[model samples]
Target: MSIVTDNPFLRLSGAVQAEGIDLGVAAHYGNPMIEQRHLLAGTAIVDLSHRGVLSVSGPDRLIWLNSVATQRLDRLEPGESAETLLLDGTGRIEHDIRVLDDGTTTWLLVEAGELPGLHAWLDSMRFMLRVEVADRTAEFATIGSMAADPAAESASVRLAAAAPNGLPLVWHDPWAVVTRGGWQYAAPEGHPAADWRWSEVLVPREELVVLVARVESADSGVAGVLALEALRIAAWRPRRATEVDQKTIPHELDWLRSAVHLDKGCYRGQETVAKVHNLGHPPRRLVMLHLDGSDTVLPLHGDEVFAEKTRPEAEAGWRVVGAVTSAALHHELGPIALAVIKRAVPVSVPLEVHSHGEVVAASQVVVVPPGAGAAADVPRLPRLGVRGL
Candidate 1:
């Protein structure tokens, strides 16, 4: 709904800036399908200057962050990449922070329009702690790529991550595998995400001018947010920016696979995270939809999803089941989307999505299984011992 319109990359020929939530950055360099192929081959880069960057420094940064977030950061070693979520009092996701502690300052990368609130919240929580928070978004920006490991490999050494007397501030994506104490609620490690070698490098804002020159050169290539979103959907990745709402919890989207640590100590909403995970099931589940490509419809955020009722009570009309949160047309997969549906909705049922006054048929591939929660093993009471006789 917001726009960051004056990006330098917009000066490049054929560069089309994206609108809506990803408003400010280039959506594609003329052809999105070609961009998708370039991204998949690890030869393209996406300018993510639209993201927000922050820094948390001082002696108590790690423990302070650990106490307020869902991930364990107390022992986060330098050069280690982790993801954490800040939850509300009831354990619903409030903020998602991509964390990288370089043994000096903890660098946080958040979605566009999230920095001000997160910065204020962290500042208010300081309460005499030996930590300080600063918004560095103006000084730094993000560049994302499908480099198996950006810091280790030389995808584009010219855009080396900013290192102010420490390790490069590149966040190697932990979503490719579960972090310490995290759980996997989706398909296991060998799933499509295994092939998702993504990383984000924090570079100096001033360096973007030079980076763009290289991008426009004959040796480099650039892709758009459309390409990135399509690949992310194919990988079954849950993006906190658009996938979540007021009712969102970690289990509903299988975010426990990386952003949550079940064994971690108390934090806001930890109880609900534990309860639904260890005793009861989450009320909803996430699924990937294969949209019928015969139509020209592309669903957007909050597009209604319905179950086609073929029963005798068909007069009741199609039952609303969920809504599409993100959609993209992959170069290979055609039209696809990530939708959140009620857990009680049978996975085998036929589905459809309504957008722009057109209804398109859909089929779901489960991400978070209906029986995902209730993970703890508890022994049954021994038949109550016949009323204690």
Candidate 2:
């Protein structure tokens, strides 16, 4: 059951619910281009109620979580935010969380589908700990803003001030910076997320009405998941549902940028993470595809992506290398997508995406380059009889 099934915001905004948790508010309001523009200009709010919230309260909250998640959380300051990932024994990504800590409680923000499993795992791990994990999704709703700092804006300011329990809980994105214990896999020059100013604030479920009323009267507009997604893709951000496959490892998606703390203490799957980062390349790599717009067709998730064979005698005309994870029509970039292809796929080859019986040509924009490995840069020893000896 959808948490927001009875949400008044849907009727108030005349939002058309998307296939899943996404309520297409912009789809309802019309003019997606304008909606996207508003989002980029930091003059819009997005309903992210589909996301889940969990509260962890106890004296050992930070320490216990630090032992479980990839990021270093023991030192996370009050009101500070960070991202972490849960990996399987082989370092395959299972969960991605956005974390925020208040003085007394740690809040975890995750996909709606992840709540039950995440809560269950956390509970099972609390056999002897002082922590208490509870699913707070039913009590709190998330509102997102791309504003550089939501505290400075009118809409966010109004929402923050109206928090029934004091200031609205805001999770400012830490993706823009290379965090204290995190490493960057992308080249330092021009990572797309460098300018991303994302923030999500928690508002009481009942207080959504007040926030919605304020937005309708203000000059700022309301955007839907569509607008948020387009911007996120353009920034080369990796989402949990779209980007993650059962075999996905954090290195494949350049997740080291924000989610993994290479220097963090031991955690589950840490060995595989360290092994892959220090000794081997991930089997797959994430890429951004700029599709040819002449076809007027966009690839959907799970659409096959192929590499066009150049030789005349090629056995298979096109080899399947990957599948599209997320696709969107950017207001400025037209059609674009993020796909996870085999790491061996040559970056220079022309690509094609097959979706809905239509083939769309694509050009690769490297996100996780083929050589993204050995992030630790450990020096190799000289040969036994080398001159240096």
Candidate 3:
């Protein structure tokens, strides 16, 4: 009963559905609605229906979107999408979106369940442009692909996958242009060049309930958030709000290459990004922490990380060099976490994740480029949690 795209090959075989994973903590995850690991292992799809989709149209669509977003939209043609970002005046991330170009209309696909916030942000910034923005989450079902074939070739409602050349290629006109990840294409909705020109994903909003039922019956279940987290962490990808907190800036989290266009003109937060890259030093560096013990309870999103031998009293563990922003129990890697650590800490030193009192053993995994710690004073530390706080 699960819904598959109109590919006859996929339809002939039994319907394969996504399964959801159980994220250890409640607040850190969205819904236990999918099993994300399966998506990474092979070809799997997730019902991203919970995500939000928006449309921007009007004569000023290209000009306005180009001016406001972090990335350039003027270079894209019909049937293309790019991972773009929206930053506050300080260059800290405000929102991240996927920009889809359907030849005529521009689409913005945002995180599911985050439409209201994204919409509000867009509205607040709206002034005098021919652009018109509308929430289209209710109008279409959004699905994610981890297929081996390029995402564009898959039988999707529309294609927003990257081309071999890394271009944000689009395949159809989007009522809501959908970027796979990032923010960038928040344009005015009215230009003839940004108008809908191809066939769109045409599911009516009223049938969502039935579609859910069909989707459930076909695939065993959607991949849960845990699997997705594992996949994302492995990919070294950064997320908004969750990964970039009040303490985070674009350069520290690697957003400059993926989301920010350094060569582009000024926007909100441009100065911060520029200064940090050129002059100021980022306080902390983003790293992947691999937990050692199977019994260890994975740290929560904001749980403190400490150097065990540094201190031994309450609030005395080196004052916590960093904290876990997101974590997952990797089936293959045991417990794992994404942490933001101070650049002064040793890269290979054993560390402990302090979940109140419970200590989890962790080792630093080199994911991003070398930082101040690459040549720091790192002793061959003992097992994680060798010293208590």
Candidate 4:
């Protein structure tokens, strides 16, 4: 039987449950601004039980995972964490997974909506390999926070994860810096992820009441899903569930910085991965849109983004260049969003977001630049003997 994921945090006073895409979880605890501050201070915990948990075990788990994923996992050490993407044959993203190895077993965390597809794919691919895959969502729940290290001496509360084989199940995000065999497309000097210390800890389902007690006693703070979403946008974090579409490739959102290993061995979509990074550019690019505050409205995903034409026709209609992938009303930034725009759009040009019968004037803060990828730099040798004719 599937376990019901009724969130325990919703019992708290002023804890408003989020609706729409991420339902069944708290959206905020009365004050979103205060919740954001608490998260940054590492005193707040976000309930992520709605996320899916899967496991793979046996001797060839890492090798099997490495053979099919975008990141190298064959040599992953115990307690180490990584992230990977499962792409379709044509190079479009299908599933985004957070990977953590604990010696005896590897825990895979994914969006709840993607659990079935991911599990089915893994089970089918296990042919004769010494690997096992199972859905563990019934036995485990996910907790998210900005805690850099839960094992630290100065940690606010002593929290532990399920450790059937002695290694705790904590998946630290590797997005703060570019990982090995990866490339960075954003301007490196002033990237926003400098202060992003996000991590997810997996605890047994029965411990929900224990965590609730801490929040009740004021020993630990509890924030809502909106708090995390706001911070994620501010940090320029691109999550596959929100940022990716049917046509998404790693380079488009600067996702190659962490989720992709360019030098990895052959995988499902390596041909397209190599071809785009070395010889071509992603058709679309990612940008942060600083929305006009006068409108006082948030743009939803798939909202059309337009740009004024820079061509000879001065009176043409506003052309649609891209659409918003995710947006949030940040505590500090007023209204900001992460959008995927055309690669040909000029970085300096201002943008407009059409949402809720209003057009919000916006400006682009480049994330994945128009010229991202094509790092090979192979010079064009003058053709045979016809040099400079």
Which of the numbered candidates is closest to the native, going by highest TM-score?
Answer: 4
Model 3, residue 317: distance off in Å is 6.0
Candidate 1 lDDT over residue span 138-184, tens digit each: 88889998866554546543356899757899898888887779888
Count of residue pairs whose backbone atoms collide, per candidate:
1, 0, 62, 0
Q: Model 2 segments beyond 4 Å from truth?
A: 21-28, 152-157, 161-167, 310-316, 376-389
Which candidate number has the best lDDT? 4
Model 2 compared with the native: what TM-score? Answer: 0.92
Per-residue CA lDDT of candidate 4, range 117-177, in tens?
Answer: 8898899999999999998988898888887775454776445688878988889999999
Model 4 residue 261 lDDT score:
95
lDDT-best of 1 and 2? 1
lDDT of predicted model 3: 0.57
Report the lDDT tens digits of candidate 2 across residue range 1-389: 23555655576555665665454333435556677888888878887777889999999999999999999999998878999999887788999999988878899999888888888988998989899998887788888888766655554433452243344478988888888877777777888888798899887777777767876777456877888888899998999988998999998998988999989898999998898888889899999999999989989899999997766664658989999999998999999999999998888998999988988999999999898887666788988877862
Pairs that clash in candidate 4:
none
C-alpha TM-score for every candidate: 0.95, 0.92, 0.70, 0.97
Q: Write the per-residue lDDT of candidate 3 for residues 1-389, one digit (tens) a residue.
A: 12223321123223343332211211112332234444553334444444567778777777777777777776767766465677777676777777876656777776653567778777776688788888876555454444433234444222243222333433232222323333221122431123222222323344434444544465323343456666566544676746777656766665554566667766777777667665555677778888867565768888988875443455444347888988876656667788888866766567888784687778887544444212223466679868855
Question: Which regions of candidate 3 deviate over 4 angstroms?
Answer: 1-37, 112-114, 149-221, 308-318, 369-389
Q: Please estimate how well model 2 matches the true structure, expressed as its whole-model Cα lDDT.
A: 0.83
TM accuracy, model 3: 0.70
Task: Give model 1's TM-score versus the native structure.
Answer: 0.95
